[model samples]
Target: MESDLSTSDYLDQIERLPTHEREGQLFWKLRIRETRSQLRHLFANSRLRTSLVISLSIVFWIGLFVLFYLGFDFVVGQVGLPGATYHAQTVQFVFTLFFMSLQIMLIFSSGIILYGGLYASNETNHLLTLPIRDSRIVLYRFQESLFFSSWGFFLLASPMLIAYGIVVSAPWYYYAYLPGLMISFAYIPCTIGAIICLILISRVPHLRRIVVGIIALLIVVVAYTSIWRTLDIKDADLLGAAWFKQTFRRFEFTREEWLPSTWLSNGLLEAAREETFDPGDLPWFESGKYLIVLLSNAMFFHVILLWVGGLLYRSSYYGLNSRQARQTHLRMAWIDRITEKLLWLLPRETQLLIIKDFRMFRRDPVQWSQFLIFFGLLMLYFANIDRFRQHRQDINVLAWVNIVSFLNLAVVGLILSTFTTRFIYPLISLEGRRFWILGRLPIERDAILWGKFLFAASGSWLPCAILVVSSDIMLRVSIQVIVIHQFICLMLCIGLSGMAVGLGAIMPDFREQSPSKIAAGFGGTLNLVLSAIFILLTVLLTALPCHFYFMANESKLQTQMIPAGNLLLWLSLGLIGVVLLTALVTIVPLMGGFRAFRKLEV
Candidate 1:
């Protein structure tokens, strides 16, 4: 009886074993190997991997970095000793504050972008269904998030850090402080964890729908405030070591004055203050500040990693699975039904495309929010142009016309580019697996392309045309010049719209992660081309007219044929420049894009 019971227990143990530990171990192992192999291939394909260019570039950058580092180091080293000639402590304080502010901003913005857009998206669902372990999936996604966030931080702080390092003559070990490498990777996982927690909690019956956007906005606001406060150096000059000594006697705030970053800044100062590289005098090593920072960083890094590996990973996976589980079936009456039906007037295909674009945008608020904020700031900036024209008397008629014209040009560029990535670029890519259906459909590709073109162009220009008319009315320019400028703006708007759609169609990346991401890869270049062309045309239009007007102003030959001809020449040149630039803008991109789209497989 005892032997039979033991055998049954052993059999149950074998039955309950993990799949990898059972008969499928080899297959599971092979699957992991295959997954890794595919990922490696994708990585290799994505990277440019230019050995010579990369090496040369790195060398050039590092040379510049070292040069800047040495210069700063020498200056800061001179200031470290007692009775130093430089009373630049306030300057150092200001710089430190500035650096911290920028750092905070980068970290916070990165947090919002990663948390709401990347980490909480449908991609997580796709990843979860794969055969890979959840931990590996989490690690890979986090690494990708870190890669993007770290790059941003590097770009923001590298120049400043280099300048400071040079001024302070920082030690060889100080080279490890490469802007954001240590803290970014550490804090990023914390942000990821926080985002995961928010996602999980927000999945309650009432919170899921708007929670992501609200949390993202809150994080962005907090980030902005933190960055602003860090750099708010009000009356910094008056608060010196002597003031600190007295203030400390009366208050208990002295201890917290030396924050971790301050310690780092001061430690660098101490190291640089030394005349020679004496091991004994080197404050970084002697004061053990570097060790403390290293320990703190190490602790932060491990804690974040463990949490990400365990709790965050599980939460992210579970939260993503259940995020929108209970879709609210809002009670709709007859009017709501009629309105919804009316909204569906476009053909099913067009409606689907538009709905998809809007839904994706609405779901991911970070990108659209950026556009809104930018528009708000620009409108606020140019709302009152009285300051620009305040002290400048004798402003010509063309100057007012030019100001209105330039503003129109700017409005067109800004609004159109916002949609370049969102609506234009993704028009083709959004077709995804269904792209093969085009070959089977009776419709020509041009018909579909034209539909997208009309969609993007009409949508962008509606606002642009309204802006032109409003600006004309506000500035009270001559109707003749306004009409001509309006015509010019119309042509340019058409041209820019074509360029946006065309470039986006041609360089359409089917596997785009987000519209903003697509914009970075291709839409930005297209906008740059459009902006440059418009700027050049604007310069010629304004400059040539101003020259002719000034020439006319100086001369008494208002009725002379030569002066009339000269005025005609400037206007003709302006019109011709606008015409040619607009032509290049439309024709060049459309043809190239048509060919590119025709050749595309999917």
Candidate 2:
């Protein structure tokens, strides 16, 4: 029947065939059933986990809302900039710039998610054996990938928009239109991302890592130059009204109509004015016209993806499977040699395991690429610290600098927690059904766990410490502040790594093959919750002395004398508390994980 009909009618003919061959419908039906089953199972079996995740999400959302509310309030209250026009235009430019940058991120994130879901997944491989068209599987996986790619967008955007709505006295409908607008806008980048991932895999198939690396480098360079130029203003008043005007003017190029982010931003801005786009008049809105553009473009992409996506997925799937194998030598022995020499203090078994894990990490573009992008962005921000802080003296300067330093520490710690949860927590689980082979090896199970822990701790610490130190140097903070930050960085790395490794053993998901799937499971969620709580305690304990010292110094900037003895006493207490806390957090989980690993049947 499919052959009898033209290509346009192919889908229509599928329904007339027997239900068993109705792969498209079957896939979706199965998906629906699976979703319902998973939700039910989650609520029935893991109420605590469900409640904790939801609660953290709510708290984080509320925190973001409050932060934005205060920022918008500062602007509208005539604190940050002058004039109502400056307020509106500045915020509007911010909205456009923010969404435009977010759009770029979604494209990259969506591509990565799709690459993992499509070409790299065992599930995709299994699905190929079924009767479904490869496109349906791509669509199926796209649904999952979209959720992973876009959740951050929703989390970050919703609160800011709400704050904007409240600040602008927007109608109730602004909040109502918000979700729909965001959903539509999200699809635009994700579609572009899907197309990019498709072309890369189907065309290059090999050399993907090199090509992706070069492309990523170019984007970073472009972003760096753009940001550097934006901030490299000379002779302009750093704390002047003109600075706001000139800085935001550079982003005016994105205010054009054709861009989806522009439409989204303008639509929201207009909606706040209790108006819609008039298309022909001087009114700010498009009278829901921009919203309609988003919806229509989103729909167009959805349809296009189903058609074009299927063809690309089919070709890539078959081509990848049938591609000829090439024999090439890996030039990474130098890495092993260097690592072995550095880790010579450890036993040979543990050293070998560390080297193995290192090789695996270095070989996988997916893992290391994400690691670089996230840390690279943070370091890039740190490098431009002078842009944010003027190289001048002022009342309470020491206090403000002290506060910012601790905040940067907390931020770095938070980001490190995510990496540990995503990558470290899944390591043992990724070992999965291969444990029997490992059991037969002469290496001890303790060595296996220690190797992972050491690998995570040592690997994470250097970069985090460098970032913290670099930010401090840029801020021109005192030597005492830098020394404290370095100490905290070391503690955070060890504690967080141990926590993830420990939790992985305690809640090993041997059944799941995908690292992401494993990471998204209960263990990863629990690990994140614990890590957050741990970071909060660490920051509070370690920062109290520094904060106190700065407040005193700020109170008497001229001939100031905070007693060295008193300062030393407080510092000692703080260090002791932080060290004890770090010890507890690290040792407890590791011991638990060690016990669990020892008793495993495999």
Q: RMSD in angstroms, all models?
A: 9.3, 4.1
Q: How close to the true structure is residue 354 of candidate 1, measured as C-alpha lDDT?
A: 43
Q: Per-model C-alpha lDDT, please?
A: 0.53, 0.82
Enumerate residue pairs that collide in model 2: 276-285, 276-286, 276-287, 277-285, 277-286, 277-287
Q: Quick one: best lDDT, which candidate?
A: 2
Alpha-carbon error at 368 in model 1, in Å? 2.8
Model 2: per-residue Cα lDDT over 1-602, one tens digit each: 66666765866766564453466677778889998997898899878867887887788789899999988887777733322466657677888899998999888878887888887778788887765766677788888878877887998899999997788687777777788899999999998888788888889887788877777677767767777877777767665777777777777777878888898987887666643365554323453778889999998887787777778887887887788887777765887899999999999899888898998998877778777777777788789866767734566666767888899999999999999998999999887578888888998898899999999999999999999999999888888789989999999999999999998987788766667767766678778878988998999987888788656664743334658468668878988888999999899999999999998874
Worst-scoring 10-residue span by lDDT in model 2: 278-287
Estimate the TM-score of every prediction. 0.58, 0.89
The segments of candidate 2 whose C-alpha lies over 4 angstroms from its true place after superposition are: 1-24, 79-84, 275-287, 326-332, 387-391, 550-564, 599-602
Using TM-score as the measure, which candidate wins? Answer: 2
After superposing all C-alphas onto the true structure, candidate 1 shows an RMSD in angstroms of 9.3
